[model samples]
Target chain A: GESVGLHLPTLSVQEGDNSIINCAYSNSASDYFIWYKQESGKGPQFIIDIRSNMDKRQGQRVTVLLNKTVKHLSLQIAATQPGDSAVYFCAETGGGATNKLIFGTGTLLAVQP
Target chain B: GAGVSQSPRYKVAKRGQDVALRCDPISGHVSLFWYQQALGQGPEFLTYFQNEAQLDKSGLPSDRFFAERPEGSVSTLKIQRTQQEDSAVYLCASSLAGAWRTEAFFGQGTRLTVV
Candidate 1:
């Protein structure tokens, strides 16, 4: 997510290495959390999602960790590939119907070959 | 074999012009959503539809921005008197149900540039 203020944080990593992108959410009531990968000019693609009930969830090469006490979330990608280069976003769903998503400040992942 | 499909993948318009973006959600999906993504930001919700009924539109930026899903299968987002700030990629997504089991599928999105 781009800051309403200015500029987005960036993450640089080498191919075949592990990459970790972190986010700090503002809402403590946010129960449903999701991680989305957005490439340039494209909509966010769902990477994986985890509920507040669990602390960790793992996918093929990706893992999401949630720390409710601190309202923090993190996505870890193993063996990062060039294809992984994109903006990573963490979304939260709270409040009510429509289940609108509130996104966090995004991190741009630049993978070096 | 089909995901959400959006029309006119790209749109360029002068300020004060009117623009319409179209989205065709997957068949049988009952929930539809519209979101706007600026530059490198995460998508911000604009509106949502459950079938032909617009359940929520509070996210719409202003009255100039309107959306309709009359048939429930296809939806359209119209921006009147487009401003430079309206330039962004509009995305559409659909989901079957929200019981925390079904996933939402998103379209490629329409890139709107208001010069």
Candidate 2:
């Protein structure tokens, strides 16, 4: 079965530090990659997405870097804040027949102030 | 109206009971999706509907989980004979089919607890 997996289950960082979460996907056919943030008792919110053609995409405070050769994806958060603490998930789309996304086992990011 | 909306923000059902979850997508949206999220895990794909036509439902866990998007608008996810493992949050998302990319807008989600 095709699946996406995260390198770390949890990451703890200081409020002002930079945070980097990594994901490894098994499907190379996945053309679309997305990063989502989920707070407690809330649904996953779309943060940033990158197509296979692009190796890097930047949002307001986050950046998604894709490495197709290694099937690795990463989300980088700059100047992490307390409000940025949440479970971050990396999902891949366009791999399967259906336009559904394959999500990874989220990485919980704890920003300690 | 603004984004995807799900009813019965929380649900508590006894084992073997049947439950129905509702989702109201944004007006004029053409794609709707349902996902199940377990504790400490990301949302798992469940089913998808494109303008009332069920394009795919391969991600449904079992036959007991049924979803319908009648009239190509409001959708429902029904779980029959629910088990303890069925306890999770059901999320509904919608996207514009005409768009080039599939960027889903998710609802708050319905938390189902099977005891």
What docking class should model 1 receive? medium
Stretch of 10 with least lDDT, candidate 1 chain A: A1-10
Give a tens-digit lDDT track for model 2, residues B9-82: 99999999999999999999898999998877778999999899988898899999999998999999999999
DockQ, every prediction: 0.49, 0.46
Shift of residue A82 alpha carbon in model 2, Å: 0.8
Q: Point to the candidate with the largest lDDT.
A: 2
Output the lDDT of residue B25, model 1: 94
In terms of docking quality, model 2 is: acceptable
Rate residue A5 of model 1 by lDDT: 31
Pairs clashing within candidate 2:
none
Clashing residue pairs for model 1: A1-A106, A2-B41
Model no. 2, DockQ:
0.46
Give the TM-score (vs. native) of candidate 2: 0.93
